[model samples]
Target: MNRRLLLLVPLVSALSFAAVTRVEITERGDVLQGAAFGPAGAYERVAGKVYFAVDPKLAPNRIIADIDLAPRNAEGKVEFSADLYMLRPREAAKGNGTALVEISNRGGKGLLGMFDLAAGSSDPRAPADFGDDFLLEQGFTLVWIGWEFDVPPGPRLMHLYAPVATDNGKPITGLVRSEWEGDKRVTTISLGDRNQVAYPLADPNAPENRMYVRDTVAGERRTIARDKWTFSDATHVTMESGFEPGKIYEVVYQAKDPVLAGLGPAAVRDLASYLKFGGAETPLSDEQKTTKRALAFGVSQSGRFLRTFLYDGFNQDEKNRRVFDGVWAHVAGAGRGSFNARFAQPSRDGHPFLNVAYPVDLAPFTDDDGLLKKAAQANVVPKIFYSNGSYEYWGRSASLIHTTQDGKQDAAIARDTRIYFFAGSQHGNGSIPPRSVEAQNQASVNDYRDSMRALLVAMQAWLKDGTEPPTSEYPRIGKDQLVAASALAFPKLADLHLPRIKREAYRLDFSVEPPRVGAAFPTLVPQVDLDGNETSGIKMPEIAVPLASNTGWNLRSKTIGAPDELYSMVGSWIPFPVNRTERENRRDPRMSIEERYKSKRDYLELITAAAQKLVSRGLLLDRDVAKLRDRAAKEWEYALKLN
Candidate 1:
């Protein structure tokens, strides 16, 4: 038998129980033909399924929503399983002691691309998939075990197979709400969020089942005739004339058998605990018996999952040990998501022109009440980095994380936490050769992954050693860098208009259908300079050099149903005219690109200075400066070509 396989023998008695009951290794092989990566040496991929069993009566598992309602095993424990994919050093001792765990975003891996500057791939195997071998070269073991129950099923996609909750051998029923907003008209739509598996309608003709449509996010919901639409099946609704484009549609119906969606967080907590504090039957080689620490990275949906996970108190393991030592939630904004509630839809997220009012964007936004209160109480608060982008400020109420509930002042941040705002960027990385889709302006393309890479290193340093990460960098009301959306003073450049409206967070009461929207928590955006670039936060070379205005908010296109509404998670990039004459002809208020820079070489020089400034502050890596210099040259050409 292989030496590594022999190490799986249990060290404890078989009667003993652990949160991670079994780990089934379905596939194991060398990665990239055993390509060596720095001191970490060759990497190996381990893909499999992990089975979990948690005693519902235990404090850690008891906190899970609907845990008591879930069916129990013969041992009086709830059982679940999840897909697992991990990358580790072939030789156990060669790896970094930290296990970097990425809570899969929508069932696929993202950190490889986010930090390594590589292309997206679900099953990373090829040379390009490793993406410059950034994580491997750092000697960190990469781990991903599915924690979301509703991720769309496909090959290479990670998922959680959680059992449905029941009420004493009978199915539990609750109201499930599904919402959708799209640019193209469609005759049919799934009852799930973003087309994941939907909870089947309990009674198609139930009097409580209702459908509503609205042109804008806050517009009055007009009821659609019950006869106008019908449940095509358990998972879909069919409209005879087709749902209108750019309009919001919602359906609320009775759904039976709520999956113990809360178990998703438990799945993460258990797996991380196993890696850091393993039981008898283990997966690690003898040389790598237990990981010293575990760090978590989650983006967008998964990012919000981390916030919710902390808020819900899943960081404490079954044995009351802390799960993650450090957590980096990127672009999650200030939302906690419907991850652990009754009939929760893990895929639903809040946006300006998309999913409007869900359980997301709730009250107790800042650490004073919601986010870290439970963790602080349990003394399990992990070193946290809440990183957001410009889009999150405008679309996700990200300011709520650091600002007062009223958004009037900056709240004191916890000593263990850091919040960073990526100025003049979007939800994810901006697209290159920026193009407008359904938005009114060209989409933002200011890549901030370079800064994100530096933050990951900073997180590890803070976790492993006592090295303090960079101070929090975000716009503050006290500094006059953050202001009300209505108070924005953007220059009127050619074909560019700041969004008239933005997404706002409200105190929502979900006891009633359609939710009772209470007093709104104030939201603010970063103030802009005379050139229309954001004034505060980490300004990447693109923002600091000023070839164009990159804004967090973009209005919907006129062709769409709501022209004045802010497009969901999209930012605007309006390039300046090439020369003074072109600027004069367009009557643009912003300075011309030629007038701003003496030449392309001068522009590149300024870009370098901007990158170096961030590196000095630990907001950017010195190694990324050269790559930013090369990208600036191409952007310079693209700016001039617009003329």
Candidate 2:
């Protein structure tokens, strides 16, 4: 192994444009017990902290919300630090010359699970955790740097340690809102999203602190009696009468000392810059520094982070150099999150029935104005892939990214950009043998990760040799593939209720106690075939040759209440009857599984053929065909034995 001495030495350095001041290596260990991955050989895990000091005066730094108000050192540079972790080939020269950085999603690692098909692990140390080592075998260096400040603290989780913003050394106070929908009766809940740290309550007895509850996303808010609930602590609230299931509760309280959260994007930009362009003192040898290009991958909340990052002009470093050569933002829809505003909450995301509404899904839904304007002006526009799933169309107002502002026509895609919709899939990649919990129906089990693997390769090829990838494959208004919810022509299936309601993205005004909601933007969904499968977008083999009706919208189960509301981030899978007799007995409109295929072998063959079409079109890799067929075989068995 060509390990360097920097692992054992403390190093302090400053990049030409970035603010990375020092790197402290706290631990180093062999990955997968020193298992070798193809020609890349053995890999190791490097974990530590990365310290930064940014000059608030720089034009690039000035955009960071409250950076000027943050505490600065003697040199007038604001100081902060973040947790860092990397998985690289032991012999750096043996790896691909590109760094694949996965912005940690809520302080957790997901790249291995998404790309490598590995079981998720916050601290991946076992062989199962590495899975097939697809990423390692490809020789790409994997990197993660904590960029979220409010992520719940666990020993294995990554975190950004940022300084608070103040007004002339005095505490700055503002109204902070936290909201949640109760799944079950509960007396207490934390103020932070998923129990991460919340801003400290400024004045506990402030009469301005108010609580409101509603039954639905658009329902009227009713104030709870002031004597009914009390703040258990700065972080939690308690009610004498337990919060009812299916009700949304929101609290508005005055909080002080907001963190300069916009620095998260700067951290991402700086790390990419530092890796591509080395600093005055460096840990990597010249040969080890073979990473000439950087690619960023972020999913869900982190995906929205990338969109906001680009919109905020963080792609260009202080040196006016492009940070990432390519970026893949998966399942982000057209939304940007609360990533860069005063008193921003990075974890607060907009969803159908989950985080109802915020600054997310705001104006400039298309790329015309707010998204790419700054990047285009700076000429730092990286190749971008806005990949979403079917759920995004129904639950995330994803059509806004491709359609006109009025949803009347298709918007022109940028030359350097591509948009892909994973047909019949959910927000998160689905699982086999679909399970149901909060959703009314069986959850969608359309696995789209195999297709994602193909897209990643295509992205690399596009960057490497200028090879054009498969053209954007999303529903278009001009093609009649996208339609309004009211125009949907769904087949009547027994015991199945089609959801006619859609989540609207309303213009919000947060200047008052309760935000004044304004006119809603038009959002459309993809047209569906007879089987209730999406007609447009990249379809996996299971979607193209299926045994069930896979839909991207699922209603909340009666057990969780609000049965009329769409379950957050969930999709539904309604299996076809096993035979014609069963289909007739159930009064099903769609063809039965047995009617579609003569036998399991026939089903497998059809699955293979469907996969081959995608492989030929560069939407799926050839190696994944066998697995798709295997999964189809299981579906065949599961359908036949259905009671």
Evaluate candidate 2 by giving its C-alpha RMSD to the native, one decimal: 1.8
lDDT of 1 by residue, 249-346 (tens): 99989888888889889989988887777655544443237468999889998999999899889999988888899988889999989889778888
Q: Cα deviation in Å at residue 111, candidate 2?
A: 0.1
Candidate-wise lDDT, in order: 0.85, 0.86
Give me the runs in candidate 2 sitting further than 4 Å from their true place. Answer: 1-17, 280-288
RMSD of each: 1.9, 1.8
Compute each candidate's TM-score over C-alphas. 0.97, 0.97
lDDT of 2 by residue, 1-643 (tens): 2444654442234332358877788888888788899998998888888888888898888889988789989999999889988898887788877899998899999999999898999888988888878899988889999899999879779899998999999999999998888689999988888767898899879988999999888889999988999999988899978988898999999988899998889888888888888754555543236788899999989999989988889998988888999988899887889998888988888877777867788778666755888888888999999999988888888999988788898988888899999999988877767875677788988999889999988998898888999999999888789999987777788878788676788889988856888888899998998888889999898899988888889998899888888888889888988889988998988898878988888888888999999999999888888988888787677766764
In model 1, the clashing pairs are none
Clash-forming residue pairs, model 2? none
